[model samples]
Each structure stands twice: as structure tokens, then as C-alpha cells.
Target: MTSSARPRRRRRDRDRGTYSVETAVLAPVMISLLLLMVAFGRVVDAEGAVDAAARAAARAASLERDATSAESEAQSAAVRSLETEGVTCRTSSVVIDTGGYALDVGVDATVTATISCATPLSDIGLPGLPGSKTLTASWTSPIDTYRGRQ
Candidate 1:
């Protein structure tokens, strides 16, 4: 019994630090994967926020009575929506298509709002990733058929 126990003790001693070695080898890989997941999640979140901003801009523009006011309101609405959603863009642009405002009163007309946002990813600490990604979203809302437009 003493002889058998001696060999088992020696084997256990040899394997004592193996767990630490394995952990050291795998920790970075695990952390890298975690970082990647977080980066992707941020990008998806930014896309959703951009889409919401576009929708808000289009809706605001569609509610206006004239093309000039529609364009101004769309820009303001997009900025406000982005701020409310906590999305910070390196550079942003809002484009409004107010041609629908010039259409005949009885015609089915729609206003389009396009929002482009350059979302910063440099803070994510992932190597080999781009510093920024540009995401664009567009939304169209119907103009009031009976409302006067110019």
C-alpha cells in the first residue's frame, strides 16, 4: 500500500501547476473572444439606433405642411433622436427628400429621410479592427393627402 501511494503522490505533484499553465494559455483567447462579442454587439446597437433616427426624421418631415419646413424639421428630429438613443457618431449626415411635398394633394406622396452615422469602434480595444464603421438607414413616411404643400 505504501509503494502504490508513493507513485500516486509523485504523479499528483507533477500535475499540480498544470491547471495554472492551461489557464495562462487560454485566458487571452477567451478575453479576445469576449471583446469581439462586445464589439459586434455595439455595432448592432448602433445600427438599430440609426434606423430609429431615420424613422423619427421621416415621421417628423411627413407631418410638416411644406417642403422647406419638412427639410428643417427632419434634420432636427434626426439629431434629437440620436441624442436620445445615446449614440455618438464621429460624423453624421441627414438627407431629406421632400419631393412628395410638391405632389398633387390627392396623390399618394411620401417623404424620405436618410441618416448616415460613422460609429467609432476604436475604444473597443480590438486590434486589426477598423476605427469606425459607417451605418446608414432610410425611412419613408406618407405625406398627408389632404394637406397643402409647396
Candidate 2:
């Protein structure tokens, strides 16, 4: 047998199972990376939902003329915003400040809304992560000086 033929036979045997071995080593890494990305994406989406909820609720409360109506409107707006964005929270709270209603219309007054949302990360069950994360956001809207006051 020629030396070249012997070398060629050795090379073929060495490479025979390389692809299968590489796949076995790389498959888990790729899958883990994919799972991590999904978890991160979900958290980012929840962050956006919380921001939108705070803004919507604050705006709704600012538009109301009375504290009673403002609180109700803010809570409703926050829930609607979260539901529309497909973000599920284990606990949700909304606090509305309608101090602007008592101030003179010409005075600078602002309505503030604070929202707290606790979301469960256990639903995804990613490794080395906590069970839940809480997100809180506050937004303020200025009352228009020219607008009628209750």
C-alpha cells in the first residue's frame, strides 16, 4: 500500500464522527442561549408594559376634575394598559394624588400616579433566577391652568 493511501485512510477515520461530536457539544449551548434570550425579552416586555401603564394612568387621572373619579380612572387605565400589552402581574397597585384639585387653577399643580407591578419569573422557570420581580414607575401630569376646576 502507498504511503499516501495510508494517510488518506487515517484522515477519513479521524474525521468520521467529528460532526456528530461537535453537534453534541454545541446543541446544549445553543439551546441555553436561546432560553436566556427569551427570558430577557420577556423581562424587557414587562418593563415596557409597566412604563406604559404608569403613563396612561397618570394622564387619565390628570384629566379628571375630582379625586374620587381620578383614583377610579387611574386604576382602570392601569389595568387596561397591562392587559392590552399582555403582561401578567401577581400583584398590582396604583396610587393617585389629586392634590391639584384643591389648588387654585392659576397655581402650578400636578397630578402624580405611582404604580407597582410584581411579575412572576417562575412561569418561565429559567435557572439561577428569582421567582418574581417587582417593577415600579411614577408619572406626573400638569394640570392646565386654563381648564375648569371642580
Candidate 3:
């Protein structure tokens, strides 16, 4: 404690390597958290896109006058919606259910569109995760009771 002598170092001052040690301990955890967030975000985004596609396809199908046209329109709508989001589908499929066409006026019928998409995320290289994830979405639109049946 003499004026000429160096002051006694506090315990905190003695630890010059603490930052490196803390960084070494925290780097992997931080990196892992970041990667998990990215993957989760991708999945959420894909889900939203697929849901939108399903809704669009169902609406398009409901607007069609015939089963064939409905099917085609549904497929096109689903594909276009997904593509607009820049989500690549390894193998995408659209199925339209036309059972409601048989119902008569005053009865409700539904146009249903189911879209299944296989998106690859192998590039992320996360262990225990599948190379590809299948995302499926379905939507139903009610056909107008007065609409003509075909």
C-alpha cells in the first residue's frame, strides 16, 4: 500500500484470460443457438408459404366450373404461390377433392385442396435432423349453393 509500491491487484484484475475463457465456453452455445433459430425460421416460413398455397389453391378450385378445371387451377395456384416465396419443393403435389360436386342446390359442398411439399435442408448439416422435411397443408372453400354442378 506504499505510495512507491504497486497497489495490490484485485481478483478481478488478475484474470486477464477470462474473456477468452468465457468466449471459448460460450462460442459453441451461441453458434448452436443461432443455427437453431435459422432452422426454426426456415420451417416457420415454409409452413406459412405452404398454408398460403393451400388457401389459394382451394379458392381457385372453388371458382372453377368443372372438376377438371378445378384440379388444374388448384395445382397451378399452389405451385405459383410456393414459387413466389422462393421456397424450392423437391417434389410437390396438389390434390383436389371434388366429392362436393354431387350435392344439389341448397346443400353445401366444399372444394378442398391439399398441397404436399418436400423441401431439402441438408445444407444446414445439423445432426439428428432429416435431410428433407415434408410440409403439408390443406384448405377448404365452400362452393356457392346456387352454383351449377359439373
Best by TM-score: 1
The lDDT values for all models are: 0.96, 0.88, 0.87
How should the candidates be ordered by lDDT, best one leading?
Answer: 1, 2, 3
* Model 1 lDDT per residue over 59-107, tens place: 9999999999999999999999999999999999999999998789989
Better of 1 and 3 by lDDT: 1
For candidate 3, lDDT tens digit of each residue in 2-114?
A: 64343444555778799999999999888878877878888889999999999999999898878888888888999899999889988988889978877887798899999
C-alpha lDDT (0 to 100) for residue 9 of candidate 3: 48
Q: Weakest 10 consecutive residues, lDDT, candidate 2?
A: 121-130
Compute the lDDT of residue 4 as modeled in candidate 2: 77
- TM agreement with the true structure for every prediction: 0.95, 0.88, 0.85
Best candidate according to lDDT: 1
Q: Model 1 Cα displacement at 113 (Å)? A: 0.5
Q: Considering TM-score, where higher is better, how would the candidates rank from best to worst?
A: 1, 2, 3
Error of 2 at 13 (Å): 1.4
Q: Which stretches of candidate 2 lie over 4 Å from their true place?
A: 148-150
**How much is the lDDT of residue 120 in candidate 3?**
84
Residue 82 of model 1, lDDT score: 95
